[model samples]
Each structure stands twice: as C-alpha cells, then as structure tokens.
Target: MSVKNLLHSSKHSSKHSSKHSSKHSEDILVGVGLRHPHFTDILTSAKEIDFVEVHSENFFGQGGAALSVLQQVRETYPVSLHSTSMGLGSFADIPAHYLARLKRLTQTIDPFLMSEHACFTWGHLQGQLMHSGDLLPIAHTHNNLKRMCEQVDRVQTYLGRELIIENVSAYVQFDESYLSEAEFLTALCQQTGAKILLDINNIAVNSLNFEGGDIEKSVVDYINVLPIDSVAQIHLAGCSDVPHGQLVVDDHACPVSDDVWQGYRQALTRFGAVPTLVEWDSDLPAWSTLIGEAQKARDIANAVLGVNARASVMEINHE
Candidate 1:
C-alpha cells in the first residue's frame, strides 16, 4: 500500500482505459450495503451497481440460506465484506476464533474488499475480558499507534491480504492525545501497508459533535490532510438530525445531507474517484430508494471526473 504501489496500480488499470478521465472514473466502484430485506430486490432489479457489501459476521455459518443468498448475489456482482466487530484497537489482539470465521467467509465469498473499524471493542471487566458490542475510541498516542500497527500486521498476516481500517464516529475525544486522527491514520498506512475506508457521514457527525462549525469545510479539511494514496474506499451514509444538530446520531437511516455531499465532491477531487458506497441500515429504505442514493454517489463522482478531465485537456492544449 505504498505510494509507489498505488501509483503503479492506478497507471496499469487506466492505461488504455479512456481518453476522458470521466470514463476512467467510471472504473470507480459504487455500491450499497446488502441487507436482508433487499436480497431478492438487489438481484432482480435492473439498477446500476458495481458491487454489494455485507457485514462479514452475518454469513459466518457453515451452510445456511444467508450464505446461499450471498452466493447468488455474488454471481451477479462483486462483494465486499465489512466486519463491524474486528476491533483492531482492542487491548488484546484480534480474537482468533473471530478471525478464523472471517477467513472462512472471505474464502467462500471472495469479496472485492475487506474492511473493519479502527476502534476497540474488547475490554477487561473485573479482570475478565468482555466484548463491548460497540466501537470504542482509542487515544491517538505513540504507544497506541505501535499497538495498532502490530495488530494490523498480525491480521494481515493471518488473512493473507491487506485489511482496510475505517474511522468511526465518536462521542468523546481524549485530552492527553497530541496526534491528530489523520496523522495517526497516515502512520498506520505507512507502517502496516493497510488502506482507509473514509466515511463521509462520520466526518460530519464528528464535526457537529466536536467542532460545531461549518461541517462541510471540516470534512474537506479532514480529507485534505489524509495522504491520497492511503484512501481505498469511501462510505456515504446519513446522520440522524432529530433533536438538534449538536446531538445528532450517526444512524445510517436518513438521506445524506447536503453538507456530506459537498464533502464527498471535495474528496473525489482529492482522491480521484475511489470506490464509494451508499449505506442505509436502520430505517431501511426500499431497494429503489436505496439504489437511488448509490446512483447519486455515482453521478457526483462522474461529474467531478468530467470537470477534471476537461480541465486536464485544456491544460494540455495550453501547454
């Protein structure tokens, strides 16, 4: 996941791909999270989608209808395994049993990408280890960074593939930590050869919870700070603005806010059309509605790419 390797991949994938950058940008994959209700709809619908993502824990069974559904879906499109419980930041290493199950699922589905959160979930309770069942934040310090790097390395070695880590929305920030989240993520990628799953909605939620300024700018600045080569995927989801803006929740139920969309455009400008996913989990939408969100992401990316392509052509002609 070094800059050199990413650059070579970009060049190799795009060579003879298209004269227009927009066409190359079409290579940028857009997908929706596969939920239970939409199983038949996703396979039957004629909607345009590049891939479908599933939470890895959902299909760890030896044999079941869930795995069968996934297999049927995989036959039609690529799959991505998004694990919610592989808390890489936990005090202990990733649980071997969990990793074994995930490895089997990955072997079965052959997902296009594998991802988990950058937060910790396991903690000691009265001298006994317990699962928190939620993503918990870790302080951004040198020691934590070293631990994360080691954990990431072990996971990669066991999985025999690179694992992409995602930033989670948080309710609290550590006071003693000096390193910015971006700096920590940068070093993690540089050291462990892993990539990032940039969640645009989480950025906005954090901005509202912590900064309370113009969230769109906050998102743009956050994306700008990350090394471009480190980002491998983008997640577009919605926040719950029920009670007030400050107390909003990262519930992936509503439509993506205008602010997040603006940030997404900025992200594409910086990251060059990375794989983007539109996720709606809680108040699940009809397949048509959910697919509409995915289409919007695809459209925004193509628009940005079209502008870049034309700008590039003009620059070349000027030269």
Candidate 2:
C-alpha cells in the first residue's frame, strides 16, 4: 500500500488519544514555541494547544521564575525540550557538567521529547574554549558525521532517550563537504540512532539561498531523501527576505510563508503526521496570533491526513 493509505489505516487502528479527544489521534500535533510574552495568556487561557516546545537552556537553572513558570506549564501540557547550546556537532566534547545539569532538568521535567541542533556552537579558538552563541554549520563530511554521532551518542546515553537533531539554515557551503545535508543526517541516524527534527522553514530558506528554482520541489526532494522513520518532529516558521531579495533569512519573526506551507504539505504526504511545532521567536505576536498559526497548521494537516485515512478505509472495504 502507499504511505498515505497505510497512514490512514493506522490512524483508525491506533489506540492513542488526541489532546482534545475530539480530534483524531493520528492527526499531526500543532503547537507554538512558548515565549515569555505569551506565558501569562497560555497559563490562563482555555486554549487547545497540542503541546509546547521550550529552549532547554531557559530552564536549566536550579531555581528561578522561569523554572517556576515551566513547572506550572508542565502541569497542563506535554512539553518538548529543545536545546540551543548542546553543540552536538562541535569538535569539542560537550562538557560533562553541562550534560549532568541537563540530566537533572530531564529528571525534573520528564519532557515528552528532546532535541538539539546539528550545528556546532562551541569550539576551541587560540587554545581557549569559546562559544559562538550561534548555530554554525558543520562541514558535511565523513569525519564530521562521525564526530556528530559521537556527540549524539553521549547525549542519548546520558538521558537514556533518543535525541532529535535539527538541521541548521546556512547561507554558505563548505568545499570540504563530501555529502549533502540529507546524506549526512541519514548517516548520522544510521550510526547513532538519532532522529531528525525536520525544519521545513529552514529547508525553504536554504533553498532560496543556495538554489533558486522551484523551492517547493527542493523541499520535497530533501524530505524524500531522509529516512522517513528517522523523522520524529517537524518545525514550521517564517523567514525574512533580504534587502536585495537575493537571500531568505530564517528569522522566525513572521507567519508561515506560502512556500513553506506547500513544503509542509509535501512533508505530510511523505512522512505522514508527525509532532509539528510552530516557531515564532522574534517580533513576538499576541498569544492568540501564535495559537491561530498553530490552528492553521492543524487544519491543513487534518484536511490532508483525514482525506487519506478515509480513502484508505474505502479501499480496504472495496477489497
């Protein structure tokens, strides 16, 4: 059977319950990044959010107002911990103390999922350990892939759970890279069992920066190349056009773009329903706006998956 048909059949047979209970459990989960501006509203409103993702570094401190807020949020919704500084692709080993701290946080939060970037943020410079405070792309070569696998293995071993690594948006390409981004990620998953947090927006952005023809097709090709089962989550966000309209920056400051929405649809068709998050970090909007974007994603996913599920059932009955 085709993937769509299989997904449709699985949805009806699956025993898992949706957050709303009224919605299909197999429908893709749609959520927004929990930012400080929307905390009060999220804590008080009667919104129907499937989940919320937070930067793991935000609540790493032992005791703080942020932790208190997260504790309260954890009480009501499923949480995904996204780490910005784990530097999984860095040549330098992740600090033992830092991993220990994250382990403690995991013990406390018991998050439903955890993720970090495929890019490195820390490296040795002039015999000193320096943090770039940015998601720097790594060369897509065999050696770098091996190093990344080692880093992911260390993190998963410490947490006793699989880690999802997100692909980073890059404007520049390295000459030393021997593999495409998709190939590197696929190899990483095969070697270390790490899953992918496929960021559709990033793919769109990189397509615009690197290749200019048929952005949607590029995204579809990228998703097709990935190991389908290795994808654990999906991220949707907005990008900004450069002054000259020559580059698209992954700023995450606006609503989902049309090209991105198209890419997301293709992803659903290829990967089926995955836990998808709507990320809007900069130029934060009202809480309702963020929720609205998530609702839009939910609608699109449901419409696509619902049709496939129904079609699959009809085929089975006819057979």
TM-score top scorer: 1
Candidate 2, which segments miss by more than 4 Å at Cα?
Answer: 1-26, 309-319
Clashing pairs in 2: none
- Give per-model TM-scores: 0.89, 0.88
Note the clash tally of each candidate: 0, 0
Tens digit of lDDT per residue, candidate 2, span 184-233? Answer: 99888878877788999888888888878478878867877886576878
TM-score for candidate 2? 0.88
Scored by CA lDDT, what does every candidate get? 0.80, 0.79
Q: For candidate 1, write residues 1-319 as lDDT tens digits.
A: 2322332222322431232233356677889999999988977888589888999999989998889999999888878899998889888767789999998997888776789988898788898777888888889898898888888887877776677789888888898679877788888888888888899888888888888757877876687678866787889999677666556678898988898898887777776768889989899988999889988998888887774754643443332
The lDDT, on a scale of 0 to 1, for candidate 1 is: 0.80
**TM-score attained by model 1:** 0.89
